[model samples]
Target: MPPDALELLSEKGSAERALTAALASFQEQVQAVPSLDLAAVVEAAKPAFSSGIAFSAQLVDVRGRHKLRVIVMHAGGAEVTSEEWADEVDDLLQAAGWMLAMLLGIPLAKQARPVEAEIAEAECLAVVGVPDASAGPEPSKKEDAAPVVDLDVALEPLTPQEIEATHQRILALPQASRQALTKAFREHFQVPRNARSIGDRITQHQHAAFIDHFLEECEEQSLDGAAAPAEP
Candidate 1:
């Protein structure tokens, strides 16, 4: 978890009592973590920016008392299997929310009351990684002046490296599946007449998701005892 990466955070629960109410206080952004549409997946190559957090919880009986146990999932997968417990429901939720934020690489400035978990003093105070004072000079104000920026943030456009990587992954498919994927790409987009047209078509689409879906379909077809041809 890179401390400042917050793409999308969603909460769904197994128990709907105090647990559901607690999760409701949390928030969500962008798409669902486990399942997302094409629009939501745009520029999602970086795992930090694309990961999702899901919190599943259940009530457990310890001896004769009940406790709330929260299980957290990152990017649709459970990162840790250890149990985190809370005696009271609200206290449990606050701690869970704090943990969720921490997993996204952030710590809350106003942490909740003292729990059995060690409370670090730094967590209550702001922890600055790079002070603004350390940043070089501020841009001079002039009509035509612009801040110096070495890289364009319009990174939504696919880079050559990403395109080449996708192309290689697509080409790694079974020859028949690879050919079918190329054909699908052509049907979706017009390809120019050239020796490298197949590769070019794949590059233009810049859609690794399509290939992943194709591979999934292949797996399903294999399980069904028949080879399935990928559809565009």
Candidate 2:
């Protein structure tokens, strides 16, 4: 295999090993919680020349009623330093672990200790290419002010009543549906928790597009639930 392929294979192996160890630790930590049962599978391949790491985890409760699919991606170059690579993989594992913990109502900080140390030690040899901070062209006022003009007709600040109404709508969703919507909204807009207005992170046109998509999803879910036969 070529060097990059070999390096990716090595990283994949390390990540799998760390995940295995972490799963054991996670199981032990959750043993005391009678209501929680969790399992995870980490995919074994990290493709060569890939720009980032991507993985999927399936989480299910003991009775299998609540199932969650988690997909995580961390962006970085193929030529990252060993420390950066370790950090990236560790971050993925920790994220999966924490998500599982949250679903099980387990305390993440208290249970993730052992796996954290194990992941920290799985280091390899590699060189990272760092960009030169001073090499970029100077920022011009024209470039900085261009967005203001573009968004002048396409965006408007939300009124307090509108924000409150949106919050109320969100609060009316079932817990699982609410969580899913909240996560999707946050990821799509890349906004902080305090950004209550749709226009705070996107143009008015974009906001309307997202609202349409969100409502469609909600409607689909409602139809699915209605179609599903009542559980025993």
Per-residue error for 132 in candidate 2, Å, reads 37
Q: Against the unseen true structure, what C-alpha lDDT does each candidate score?
A: 0.36, 0.37
Each prediction's RMSD over C-alphas, in Å, is 26.2, 21.4
13 in model 2: Cα distance from truth in Å? 32
Report the C-alpha lDDT of model 2 over 1-232, residue by residue, as the tens digit.
Answer: 8999999988866665444344334433332222112222221121210324444465445363433344333333121110112222324344344333332223212133233232221210000011235536743522332223246544664443343234334433333443455455566667765332222233244454444455454454445545556669
Tens-digit lDDT string for candidate 1 (118-195): 122222111111123533574222212222223443224454445445544543343334445555555544554322
> Which ranges of candidate 1 are over 4 A from the true structure?
1-155, 193-195, 203-206, 226-232
- Evaluate model 2: give its lDDT: 0.37
TM-score of each: 0.26, 0.27
lDDT of 1 at 127: 17
Error of 1 at 162 (Å): 2.8
For residue 164, what is the lDDT in candidate 2?
Answer: 27
